[model samples]
Target: MVQTTFKNNAVTLIGNEVKVGDVAPDFTVLANDLSPVSLKDSEGKIRLFSVVPSLDTGVCDAQTRKFNEVAAELGDNVIIYTVSMDLPFAQKRWCGAAGIDAVQTVSDHRDASFGEAYGVHIQHLRLLTRAIFVVDTEGKVAYVEYVPEATDHPNYEAAIEAVKALTK
Candidate 1:
């Protein structure tokens, strides 16, 4: 239950706080095809869960694209999941348009599974606050960054560094 804000106004988050060393919470987010995707689907891989409110925004777009590029450089064992409350169709369209193949866009719009599970769900907005979670190959959370402001960008280098740690 981490408290955050959007443009200086308080917003409530609804879920357990995810910390380093904790077993990553399982969540069912929708793929671009509207198929269910969960942590188990990418088991045994280092996962970078980049949670954003919407891909269409400036910060969120930059965040996703940054990970997309990093994902391309990371080896096959590493996978990036971009979770958002946007619909699967929108996510697919945005990814295709932006040429974001390295990162997979997952939708939590249907049920807020990923949002709630990751403790990023905004009480009033029903959108996920900005955050990043790195899960090692063993399914343990290696790092987490819950951005204090919804409109602010996350610490990109720290998140990437965490993923790099898992790869090594």
Candidate 2:
């Protein structure tokens, strides 16, 4: 399992670790409108998932905002999603306040489906550790970054590059 820490404190992560070239696992998350959204819902598009503990936090907010700003440039074939354990209502409210229309904010609060599927569930905290995953158009994981520190930012450039490659 990949080791993760929040504020230097080790946290147990459940679920199987995902690696590059692996078939992207399908998981259900709630859209801001409370509709169930699965990985298959966005079939044929390169998808980038920005997993975060919570959007209300500093790093998570910045991470989502950064991705939102770049979504348009990523082309119409790529969709960026910011997944969190926050409630759907909370996700909707945060996106509104942050003007995060480019990136879709999905909620895993119902069952941690996305967290467990992607191996980002912070066992004790019930929050997802920071991570980034770029799935190619064919549903293969092109790049995976499980941020060692939950409070830190992910490698935005690498993840973005992965999506750009898939678009080309």
Candidate 3:
């Protein structure tokens, strides 16, 4: 279990905590159309997993949009996926309303598979803790960030730099 903060209060996160150089755990999440999407499908590409608690909130919305903006410049070899616990329909609606097209939102509300595997599942809230995971083309985790607080934004520059380095 990992320790994180919710509103600055200590909270426990369930599942295994991933680290750089570790192989990413495979998981399935729902696409906006309710189609199943898996990590393995993006094999042989650099991928960024931008995880948020919920998309409707201000910070989460901002976080997703920021990554969406960065996605446009990263080229096709780098895929950015925003994972959250929101339902697929809600995700789709929010994306449309927010004009977020660069990043594909994946719903882990079905079973919290991604959250559990990545050790960002907030035990009390049943939502994912704010985090970022970058995987290399070979499927090894290249970087990880479990934001200390749920409401805070991640180190965007660091994550973006990690992906950019992969393209070099």
Top TM-score hit = 2
**RMSD in angstroms, candidate 3?**
0.8
Task: Tell me each candidate's TM-score.
Answer: 0.97, 0.99, 0.98
Residue 150, candidate 2: alpha-carbon lDDT:
95
Error of 3 at 100 (Å): 0.8
Q: Which regions of candidate 1 fall more than 4 Å away from where they truly are?
A: none
lDDT of 1: 0.91
Per-candidate total of colliding backbone pairs: 0, 0, 0
Per-model CA lDDT versus the true structure? 0.91, 0.95, 0.93
Which lDDT tens digits does candidate 2 get at residues 53-134? 9999999999999999999999999999999999999999999999889999999999899999999999999999999999
Better of 2 and 3 by lDDT: 2
Q: Highest lDDT: give the candidate number.
A: 2
Measured with C-alpha atoms, the lDDT of residue 163 in candidate 1 is: 82
Candidate 3, residue 72: the lDDT equals: 73
Stretch of 10 with least lDDT, candidate 3: 1-10
* Candidate 2 worst ten-residue window by lDDT: 159-168
